[model samples]
Target: MSSIVKTNKFTQALSDCIRSNPKFKAGQSYADLSMWTRLCVGLSDTEIFSMLPIALRNVWADEEIHPLLQERGAIGTGRFNVQSLAATLVCFRRTETQNSEVRVLQSQLAHLSHEFNSLSFSVFDILKRLDRLEAENVTLKQALNIGGLSDDPAGLPKTETQQISIRSDQDAVTKYVL
Candidate 1:
């Protein structure tokens, strides 16, 4: 048989298989399937039109798409067979699903990353406040120590031990004025 005849038969068979498969029929329109086919194979319109049945067969028979095609009972041989084409379509569909899932996951990761940055800033601010407070506490403790106050066993200043000192010169001035 001529290669052109085989290619047409193969294309028809693939179309039939897609229509018969409930998942394929429900998930994509003919136009959508066509577009996806081109996208998945990264082929131009002229290249796709001129592609041989063997080339189409090889695409579906790839290691990635073969197993899925077999699971769907769409594997076949010959120019009249649609199994290869059906497999290619299924593979494209799977790729689309995976791409969508990846997008969702990426979005979630971005949100989480943002939240982590915010939390880090908050923690840093808290640490800075704690350090400032610690320094102030140390300075206050030193001042209390210099003011003739002793820290009790409970870590508080002993207020009863505090005494006011008066200079003798000031006392004599008060006596002279009186």
Candidate 2:
């Protein structure tokens, strides 16, 4: 993993950023921001989200918003008070769109996982039934005295003689049971 950059001071980085992009108005609001917010630059994108400036401050004081407006013109600055931010969000009016989409995707994933597990169980059950059928087939072949029988031989087959021999044995066993 790459090392985190601790050396880029806020003032210097801000100046460097604004110099490169003349239209970037996001930096002016961040000048008096908490250090925690500044440190987040390394983790998050270089460009500020419009909502982030209001969220990061520990306090939502109106006095804080007033100073930033005096330092920079209103156009490039979004140093907003709580009331203004709430009003702006009200204008946007699609607050539930992102959250609802995420919830829908998560529920879909859960449904698919449940279906896959049930299918796996069905496959296992089929394999067990096949094994039971194979066992029954083996037992029937042994009872008929054909368990050792091979394919039709070049000479006379032994299976006919074996079945004939077992007939007498089965008759004697049946008499004993009676």
Stretch of 10 with least lDDT, candidate 1: 158-167
Worst 10 residues of 2 by lDDT: 1-10
**Where is model 2 more than 4 Å wrong at Cα?**
1-79, 82-95, 146-178
User: lDDT score, residue 6, model 2?
Assistant: 26
Q: Give the alpha carbon lDDT tens digit for every residue of 77-116 in model 2.
A: 3345433533433323333346678899999999999999
lDDT of 2: 0.48
TM-score of 2: 0.34
True-structure lDDT of candidate 1: 0.58
**lDDT at residue 84 of model 1 (Cα atoms):** 41
Q: lDDT tens string, model 1, 57-92? A: 664656654555566554354654434444556666
